[model samples]
Target chain A: MLELTKEPFFGFSLCMFSYIIGIKINQKTKSALANPMIIAAIIIIAVLAVFKIPLENFMIGADFVAMFLAPATAALAVSMYRQFDVIKKNWLPIVVGCVVGAVSAVVSIVVLCKFLNMPQDITASLVPKSITTAIASKLSEQLGGIVPITLAAVLVTGIFGAISSPYLIKLFKIDNPIASGLAIGASCHALGTSKAIEIGEIEGTLSGIAVGLCGLVTVFIAIFL
Target chain B: MKLFKKTLILFVVCFISDIIAYFLPFPFPGSVLAMIITFLLLLSGLVKVRQIEPVSDFLVKNMAFVFLPSTVSIVSYLDVFQSILWQFLLICIVTTFITFVCTAYSVKLTVYLINKRKEKTENA
Candidate 1:
């Protein structure tokens, strides 16, 4: 069994299987919280726990899935490129919004941490919560925060942003696709970008740009602050 | 040949940015440097936006899969989190709420400003 687990394909298969099941669960539940990733994680964890399988054994398979992050993040450039015209025309507002959103995200986390008297490490982890996980993880590690905590924070932030954005936009009567997409992407990252795509082509493109810019701006702020 | 050259340039830009980021003493990861470099390249028209589409699209599509490694790491740190689960939960919930509120308010404000400016210009 251990020997079987060591095969690279084993982990890849498990990850893919889990992801597929997660998607199915999401479709069945029709709830954002039932996200395929989250559902898959729970299923994988439960199975591992029940079978008394060590995490190390399971990770041998899961790492295969993680390797795709680089390519996926690179793919966002397509959306950015597609929206170049809109980006060029409203460069000033978008830049200002991203900067403000990124700074506010960090500042609010710090303020809350101070008020709650949370541990410094936790505070550090929370600082990069609004950025994408790839960037946030590195920032967390450098700041001496827990990477897992930051990952979890990023996941939750994205989910929240994705789910609530539509309602928020409706309530605020925000008609501009650029504004809508920027708000969601800056607050939630890729997850929000997914929902932004569903909202409309323009919103989707703008959201993609926001994700990249938010990640960039948050990185600088995370380092300095 | 031109397409290949442009692709090569894109890869070189990304690679060089990564290298520069590695040498930086900043606390954040090096990918941010790559992004900044990419943005600069785009801004300067040294690399047209169209050229980087293939690479960026690849990155965006598989974005969620990247978190699996870290999620797996959760198993190793189960003990640490178990002890501080409540704290972690609180931080996650509150920070998320704060982010949403701040982002929404900022968007609203910006929209208001744009509208005001438009009105003033029209009246003038």
Candidate 2:
């Protein structure tokens, strides 16, 4: 049984199987906290521990799936293109909102990191927390940060954003759909967009567009960092 | 055949972006560079949306699954994370809240200012 771990198929099958289970739980619960990635991560980790499987052995096949991340990131262009009309009409607000959001996210993280005396790698990992996971993970790698920590930070930030955005909107008295959606995407990425969709169609569309815009703006700011 | 062909185009774009990034002085992300190039290609009509639509849509939809293994691998770094768990949460929660508020208000303010300017021009 332990020997099976050596085959790439073992890890590949494990990841796929766990993800399906995770998706089922997500659907059954219909709760934001039941995120498929989070559930899958917990299940896989538990299985690996129980089986005494080494992380590297599982990584053999896992790396194959990770390879798709690049093309997937590229695929985002298609979605952005899909939103070309909305982007054109509200170009000024979308661009400005994302820029401000990205700047604030980075600046606040830096300031807190400095105040907390956090290590450089952790700080770097936390810096891209607000961007989508694919971009955040890659940016974290570019900055010499720990990729896993960055992934964790991104997930937590997303869940928080999804759960809190509705209340945040009300608290801030944000009446505009575009503004609410842009804020959610900037602060939370896809997870918040899911909630934004529930708010209204216009908000959902704007949120979706904001994810791409905020990602691009964050990457641009990372150059200066 | 169609999905394969679309995936090939995206991969080719990614491959070219990697080379471009390798030569740049800054540590630009190859993935992001690929994204920009793809977006530009789409905008310029060099690549039609349909040609890559199916594969791109599939990739986007299943993105979380692709990252699952890495997210699970977080267990390996548990010790590092353990020490900074509170700190990590603090930063994420505080920064995320601040980012949302700032972005929301700025967008509202910009839209308001734009509308006000338009109204003034209409009055004139």
Candidate 3:
């Protein structure tokens, strides 16, 4: 087993396999609720368990893909730059909407935790739930929150925002792309931004900008509250 | 010459901001600093938007793949997570629903308020 693990290519193959299988399952499901990542995670876990492959060993390969997070997040600036005109015109409303969205998310989570009498660590993990997983996980750890729980929260938030945002926009008659994007990005972070991109270029750009802005805002808010 | 100068400035801004953030004793990570620095440079007209485009685009396009490492880490800590699995699931579902409802409502309210204000101004 150790020798098999030492095979340098094994980890890479498994990561690729997980992503491919996950994408395939996602395409076949066509259900908003059925996230490819969640499905892929389950599949990967099952395979690992059956093969008795240690999670640590699998991580050796997976980490390579994860290292791209910094660059990927930085890339959001492109979309943000493209939408600078829209941002310049409606800066006030955009900023206000994001603040409202961020505050609402954080407050709702804290209130829910209090109502449920959840443990402190869990509550802390959830405080940064509106951010992307990479940032949220670090925030959770720093705040002494449960990192796993935070990751799950970020995933669910992103997927939920992605699926429901369109319906909500239509229902509310949100004509402005900037507003729509801000709402999605503020609440769901990166996952929501991906969905925003699918909606249109304007929506994508605004959401990308909002994700970064909201992350920064949430970090400041987290410190005070 | 112009493009090289712009890229150099952007890199310097990013690096300096990150370094400053590291020593700030702040709770937030250094990336936030880099973002602020970049935003300020753009807003101040010190750094050309076109110059930062390449680096920024690279970051956003592959954002999903970035979370792979941590998700894998989650797999290793399954036993720890198992104990709180139900709690975690509940939190995700509930919080997500709450965020959606709040965000939708807020957007609706903002639109309504803005429209009303416009109407009042027009009438007056």
| Poorest lDDT segment (10 consecutive residues) of candidate 1 chain B | B27-36
Best by lDDT: 2
For residues A1-225, what per-residue lDDT tens digits would candidate 1 score against the true structure? 656666777667777788788878888998867877777777777777787777777777677666444334434444555567888887866887788778878887888789878788888888888887777887888888898888887887787678788988887777777778787888888888889999998688777777777887887776667
**lDDT value for model 3:** 0.70
TM-score: model 2 vs. ground truth: 0.98
**How does residue B68 of candidate 2 score in lDDT?**
86
Candidate 1 wrongly placed segments (more than 4 Å): A1-4, A24-31, A60-65, A170-178, A197-203, B1-15, B38-59, B118-124
How high is the CA lDDT of each candidate model? 0.73, 0.92, 0.70
lDDT, candidate 3, A78-109, per-residue tens: 45566688778767667777777778778888
DockQ of each: 0.40, 0.88, 0.36
Q: How large is the interface RMSD of each prediction? A: 3.1, 0.9, 3.2
Candidate 3 chain A: worst-modelled 10 consecutive residues by lDDT: A69-78
